[model samples]
Target: MLVTPLTKLLGIRVPVVQGGMQWVGLPPLVAAVSNGGGLGILTALTQPNPEALRQAIRETHKLTSKPFGVNITLLPTINPPDYEGYARAAIEEGVRIFETAGNSPGKLIRYFKQNGCIVIHKCTTIRHAKSAIRLGVDVVSVDGFECAGHPGEEDIGGLVLLARAAQELNIPYIASGGVADGRGLAAVLALGAAGANMGTRFMCTVEAPIHQNIKEKIVASNEQDTVHIFRTLHNTARVFKNKVSTEVVAIERKPGGAKFEDVRELVSGARGKQVYETGDPDYGIWSAGVSVGLIKDIPTCEELLARMEKEAEDVIDGLVKVRVEKAKL
Candidate 1:
């Protein structure tokens, strides 16, 4: 078995955690991952209110008795929802796991801990990881530049980031960004991570609520099919290459440069949600990681996670045999 600190901590059989993609972390997908022995996550702000989130949690419970988490990314939104209310709603529903990202997890950390919830904070740099550790977060999810969402300004890849984090971090961390299949999971284990956390990889799953055309687009994409936008704003996001995204990039690269308002309409969350519904890859800005290149087929979460687990075992067995052969020589 491929056991790690994450598996023990979350009480999950597999160490994998699905990314909390906005508009994509519906109950069906989350429950599927949980039922498949991995940790599924519900995006908090996806619901219109705390009551709606409560219903979603209850719905997920109906599907799987396994553990799942609610992700509440505390970012700067034009009209922010009641973030704490959503967290409390989940807490009241007996949810024990919390995945927090963006600006600061300071306030929510205290509440989560007081309620005996396990907090896994996502960070793109070593300093932020250290900060999360200092704040007593139970786990850290280290995201690299290849991550679909905000990858921070440093732009370091998973190999360098995960290796460095493994050497320095006293707490256990999982590798995020550019992870897709069992090979990626095995690579992260070698780099000292407990497991792999995938966003773009999960986007191609059969259970993903997004349109099938979007999944097909992801499968068709290569590594170079993604582009980095909002770099000038220092809030860099890696997304699939599409017409709207291309326009945003063009505006950002203008001679005089562009402002936040310049691309606000083109990159709004509503537009992205529409893209998810319509299956039009070129409709709006949507996050996709470099790992989209690694996706070749759409499988049910059960099939995907199970295959990865078997492949991980095979990889470890192969390595052990090689070591034995070398020792004999």
Candidate 2:
């Protein structure tokens, strides 16, 4: 059986994790991943309020008796949801695993630990990972520049970033961004990561709640089909290369950079939700990673995970054979 620090920590059979994807991490997909022998995460803020989040968690529990997690991304907004309330609800609902992103959880990390929850913080830079470690997170999920959504301001790819993490991190950590197949899983494991956290790959799965058209677009698009917006604003986001995203880039390139207001209407979260619900890929700006190129079909979560596990086994065995030949030389 494939196993690692992550598998042991999360009590799962495989080391694959479906990272939280906003608007996509509903119960259907989350439960599927957990049932398939991987960790699945539900997006907290995707619910309207803390109460809604509690219901979502309960619903996921009904779907799968296996372990699943909740993702509560702390973004800086004018009016924020009750972060503490959300944590309390998850704790009350018996959720023991959490994936936090965007901003640091600060004292909430302490609260979660106190409540017997395993905290996994997602970050893009080694410095940020160190900070989370100091803050007492059980695990760190490091994202590379090839990741969707916010990859931070650093442009480090998984190859160098993960190797660097292997060298520096003290606790168990996972590799996020651009990992779509078993080869990617084998690569990260070789680089010293405990597991692989996949967002785009999960999004393209049959169990993912997004529309099939969006999945098809991802399968058809290549690595270069993604463009980064808000680079000038210092909060760059990787999104699918569509008409709306291209226009956002065009506006960002012209003059002294684009303001949030300049493209606010175009990048609306509601519109992105419509794209997912309506199956119109070009209807709005949606997030996707460079791993889109690696996706070719929409398979069930179980099928996908089983294939990845076999592929990883084969790759590792092939590498061992290569090492044996080298030793003979």
What local distance difference test score does each model get?
A: 0.92, 0.93
Question: Each model's number of backbone clashes?
Answer: 0, 0
lDDT of 2 at 210: 90
Let me know the TM-score candidate 1 reaches against the reference structure: 0.97
Per-residue accuracy of model 1 over 241-300 as CA lDDT, tens digit each: 899989999999999889999999999989999988998888899999989889999999
**Model 2: lDDT of residue 28:** 96
Off by over 4 Å in 1: 324-329
Off by over 4 Å in 2: 325-329
For all predicted structures, in order, the TM-scores are 0.97, 0.98
Highest lDDT against the true fold, candidate: 2
